[model samples]
Target: MKMFLSHLDSPLGTMLLVTDDRQVVRALDFADHKAHLHRGLREHYGEVVLAEILPPVGIVGALVRYFAGELEALNELPTQTAGSDLQRRVWGALRRIPAGSTTTYGKLAKELGFDDPRAAIDIGAANGANPVAIIVPCHRVIGSNGDLKGYAWGLHRKRWLLEHEKAMKPAKEEGRTAMLPGF
Candidate 1:
């Protein structure tokens, strides 16, 4: 198992993007979270090999467009991820959440037809385990109280993504907000 790793500059921050030989994204994590990314890779594909290389041009271009305000650029990009059935389902549901909208874990569980009270917690776990980031749109899911919650990357990145997509208003001088360009 050889995976290509590349650095991508985004409005939020530098990201470590990994892609399989087929150019399908395996994981996309913040450069600052390098340890977490490597740990996830080891967990997902035990004893793997990583090589430094440029990511597929198409994927990079799409992400560049996305950060440039073409929000739908990633809608059709191809992605392949490895996870349990529940995690896969949660990721699929995440992709269905339109760019400018959001959902809570509770509502997502209901959509999956889970009536158990703990479904949200389970779903949150799966969401946290998502390998690919923006492509899976995991940031689109928020707390039931309409407040931002845990984002493996960082709350500031989550807030930036939501704000970039216009799903959330830029935090009102909350200090956690990223000083976005083109403001």
Candidate 2:
């Protein structure tokens, strides 16, 4: 598979954006998560040949606006991801998680029609397997107890993204809604 790879500047860090011939986003990840990104690409599209080039203008604009605090900026952006039936369903559900809000793994599993308690494990795994980062909104998922969980990118990045989306209060504020950094 052939794709265009471009680097875009964000407040958190440089982000890698991959787009297809139609300019639809194929994948996106932080520059720091290069390995995760590559693994995702290889799984979704075997033998990907990435060419250094600019991403779609509309996609870049949306990300710019998203980082600038416009939470709805990504709502209309188009993306295509390849995964199994359940994985695809889980990824689609992740997108429905509102930007300034969050859902728990167990809760997400239940919402997806899974009554078994262990479904949270599957949900968590699917969330980890998500190829698209912010656009898919996987960062909005938290533990059932409302504690932060592992992010493929890192816990810090997840917390930062939640704070950026106002889903969680900043680490500095002393409030029940806030999570202290390094905790």
Candidate 3:
């Protein structure tokens, strides 16, 4: 398996891109070094894909396009993601969250037809486990209190993603738009 990292210019600052020979495995908010990010990759991919070698810049380019709102669906880039069946369900649900929109965990739980918040919390855990970042749009899920919470990358990046999507979403009517808690 091939592995590499690249610097991406984004509204959230420089981000790290990690990929295997087939598809992207991880995209992280910038860190001083790659060592801190290797544990997860090592656990997920074994020794096949190591972080010592940074991935090609093109991998990062795709992410840049995504964050810029130039690319809508992210099935183009290859991603080798592993998760439980329930987690997969949650991830799939997350993809349907529209651009410039936010959904509460409780609401998502209801949409999933579960009356309990624990089920939604399970989905949230899976969302947090997601290796492919912005593409899956896990950042779209927020606390029922309307606060951003529990982003593996960091809360700042989560806030940035939400604001970025809000900025990208087209205006619906004149002088009137959906307002978010922090945006």
Candidate 4:
């Protein structure tokens, strides 16, 4: 299968977006992680054939809107990734995490039906292997103590994304407040 590739310039840094012929996003990672991206693609799909094209406008637009404070813009974009059943389940749960909220690995593991704390290590590994970055929302996972933890894109970018989402959260609430009958 031929993989379509494109570059997106984001606030944190440049990102490489990979999609299939049908335009379902397969991977999105920082441009600096080219080697990591290639390794992941090779592992997931042996012998990837890459072709460059303009980024999918709808997906890129959604990301742009997300960075511009419209956090829900990313909610509707389509994605496709190759992974184990556990990894796919973990990634799906990651998307359900609210934009401004963080969940610990233990919490996520429990949510996925794992009651033991050791399950968190497996959960963390799945999070680390998430193919799509911001769209999958893996950055929202943190340590049990609420410390920012591992993010494939780097902790600095993780901090920035969380802060950006948090800052936008108030604006959403304020908008709701303004529409209420009483000030």
Candidate 5:
């Protein structure tokens, strides 16, 4: 498969966008994880190739806008991924994570109808393994205490993403009974 690479500037830093003929495969923060990401991509896809795929550029633009607090819901990017059935389900669930919102691994597990909270860890693993980044929204997953946790790119980028989402989303009324908080 031919892959395309683009460098995008956002609030955090330069982010690298990677994609194939079908859809976006990776969106990585350019903080300190670039080398690691490059190695991983090389190992997974065997080689790195660049092509002109404008569809993903729109998604990258939207993401840049989102980081600037200009977009509330990211409904623009079309997600295409390669994974198992359960992994696909997990990716779908990640998309449901609203912009300027966050969800815990436990909450995500519950959304997938898993009874045990430990299933949350499995959900997290699938999220980490997601080939698509912002479009799939694995970064929207937070810890149980609403703390920013692991991201394939890095934790700093994770915090930046959560903050970006919070900036776009309307403020939640305190004590007004939230279906979810800290999102």
Candidate 6:
């Protein structure tokens, strides 16, 4: 399949967006990880061609809204990932994680019905291998001890994402509910 490539300037850094012919996002990663992004594409699609062009405006708008502090804006963007069954399952679980919350690798493993240490490690690997970044939400997984762990994009960006979501949650909640009892 031919991959369309585009670049977006974000507060965190420059991001590369790759879309399939149908315009579904195939991968979104930091520009600094270009090599890894290409490697992932090669691994998944095998002998694919990449063409530079403008990405879908709606997707770009969603990202802009997200970085502008509308945390839920990212949830609506469509993404397509290529991976094994376990990887796909883990990626789906990652998306289900709420914007302001987090889960440990071990906890994620448990949620997936895995209890062994090896299973947790496998989950972590899948998380690291995630093709799409923020939309897939792999950054929300932390260490069991609550420390920030491996993020393919970089730990600093992971911290920023968690903090951004944390700061936005209260405002989001306030807009959704009434503080007082029946008025």
Best by TM-score: 1
All models: lDDT? 0.89, 0.88, 0.66, 0.88, 0.68, 0.87
What would the per-residue lDDT of candidate 6 be over residues 11-50, giving only the tens digit for each residue? 7778999998888999998898999999999998898788
Q: Model 5: per-residue lDDT, tens digit, 85-169?
A: 7888998988887776788899999999999978988998888877655667888888888667788866655655565566233
Report the C-alpha lDDT of model 4 over 1-183, residue by residue, as the tens digit: 689999999887789999998888999998989999999999899999999999988988999999899998998988888999999999999999988888899999999999989999999999999999999999999898878888888876787788788822322455552221221
Predicted candidate 4, C-alpha RMSD: 7.4
Estimate the TM-score for candidate 3. Answer: 0.71
Which of 4 and 5 is ahead in TM-score?
4
CA shift of 44, model 5, Å: 5.0
- List TM-score per model, in order: 0.93, 0.92, 0.71, 0.90, 0.73, 0.89
Clash pairs (backbone) in predicted model 2: none
1-183 in candidate 3: lDDT tens per residue?
557665555655556667655545554545533554566566555674544555565565666677657656354565555566776677778878876788877787788788887877776777787766777778889988777779887776676677666623433446775433344
Sliding window of 10 residues with minimal summed lDDT for model 6: 174-183
The positional error of residue 76 in candidate 6, measured at the CA in angstroms, is 0.8
* C-alpha RMSD by candidate, in order: 2.4, 3.2, 5.7, 7.4, 6.7, 8.0
What would the per-residue lDDT of candidate 1 be over residues 1-183, giving only the tens digit for each residue?
899999988777789999989888889998989999999999888877999997689999999999989999999787788778898899989989999999999999999989996899999999999888899998999999999989998887788889999999877666665565554
Q: Is 1 or 2 the stronger prediction by lDDT? A: 1
Greater TM-score among 1 and 6 belongs to 1
Better of 2 and 3 by lDDT: 2
Q: Model 2, residue 157: displacement in angstroms?
A: 1.0
Worst 10 residues of 2 by lDDT: 174-183
